[model samples]
Target: MNRTEAHFIAQDHLAREGLLLDRLDWDAWLDLYREDAVYWVPGWIDEDTLTTDVRRQVSLVWHTRRDELLDRVVRIRSRKSVTAMPLPRTTHSTSNVLVESAEPGRIVAAASFIVHEHHPRLRRNDVLFGRYEFEIVQEAGDAWRYARKKTILQNDLIPTLVDFYNI
Candidate 1:
């Protein structure tokens, strides 16, 4: 694919991902990831720094394997998670999308996202904004899937509790 086509494909993947999450289509969403994918949201290392070493410092959320991601979805879908059951509605807006690099079968992409969560029973509405850095690899037939996803939330403290899927 040409550079422009690569950009469009990468952006399209991101847009479809957000739509799947918003609709709570867990299985479809999970299919977007590779078996060894690592989804992480690291905590800030210091008061003044946005930098964090996820390996050395604590992380807000971390899922090391695609299995873990599926497990999380199973829990919520089966209503086993008290807080996550009856999933709240969400609208995820992704922008500033860039396909930073595209090789024969690998891509590095970045985007900014604002996710709004609303719950009718709890009377809650909250917004989370962050940057997403992704390492995506091509699967069979030139399809791309996430190998690693890092979410850097702007807030030092999360306004509300969150999980990988919600964030």
Candidate 2:
């Protein structure tokens, strides 16, 4: 495929992923990734740099594999988890998406995202706005997976209380 075609396909995949997240279909959203996927929410913009040591730096969220993500899902579903109790409904809005790079089976994309959470008990809305940088890979038979996802929060260093399952 030509460059334009490749870019379009990559963009479409990104859009679909965004829509799936917005719907909060956890299983369906997880199915979009490979078993070895990585989800990262870096604390800083330069965190993605090749030379940066992520362990030494602060990060918002980072999961190395699908099992880790599944574990998180399980915890969120568990009634014993106090932080996760009374889960807040959330909507993820993604826009200003740009395909930074694209090959036959790989795509690098960046977009701005806003996660709005509404909790009836709190009687207030929690908004988390950030930028998402993704490394997407196409697996066997037209399946797209998230090789890496880095979410850079606009308020990464701020001191604020957050619910356990808010993200």
Candidate 3:
């Protein structure tokens, strides 16, 4: 497919991801990712650099396997997670989607995103803005799944708990 076509596909995929998260549909959201996908949000090391190594540096969020995400979902569903209790209502918006590269089986896309979240318990609202880089791979039967997701949060001074859903 041409770059334009690839851009549309990537944009659609990202929009669907945002919709799933907004609805708090954990199962469907999880479906967008591969089993061994890497979901990472690196912490800033300084004014200009971010932590590159997950094993040795601090990260806001990192799950090497989808099962780890599933475990977190389970906790949220079971009401066992205090941080997730009275889950925040969120709306995710993404813009400026660009297809960095598109090959036969893989596509790399990047976009800017902002998620507005309202905490039920705290009666507070917060917004998180960041840039997302996704490595999406084509699977069987026209399926596309996130092979790796790198989220770069511009505002690193998060006031509350940070999870996959919020940013």
Tens-digit lDDT string for candidate 1 (110-153): 99999999876788988899899998888999678999999989
TM-score on alpha carbons, each prediction:
0.92, 0.80, 0.97
> Residue-wise lDDT of candidate 2 within 24-120, one digit each (tens)?
5668777777789878765554544422447887666677897887777676667665654566676767777778888788888788877777766
Q: State how far residue 161 of model 1 sits from its true place (Å).
A: 1.6
Candidate 2 vs candidate 3: the lDDT winner is 3
Best by TM-score: 3
What is the C-alpha local distance difference test score of each model? 0.84, 0.68, 0.93
The all-Cα superposition gives candidate 2 an RMSD in Å to the true structure of 3.5
Residue 49 lDDT (model 1): 61
Q: If the candidates were sorted by their TM-score against the true structure, best first, what order would they fall in?
A: 3, 1, 2
Candidate 1 vs candidate 2: the TM-score winner is 1
Q: After superposition, how far is residue 151 of candidate 2 from its true place, in Å?
A: 0.2
Off by over 4 Å in 1: 48-51
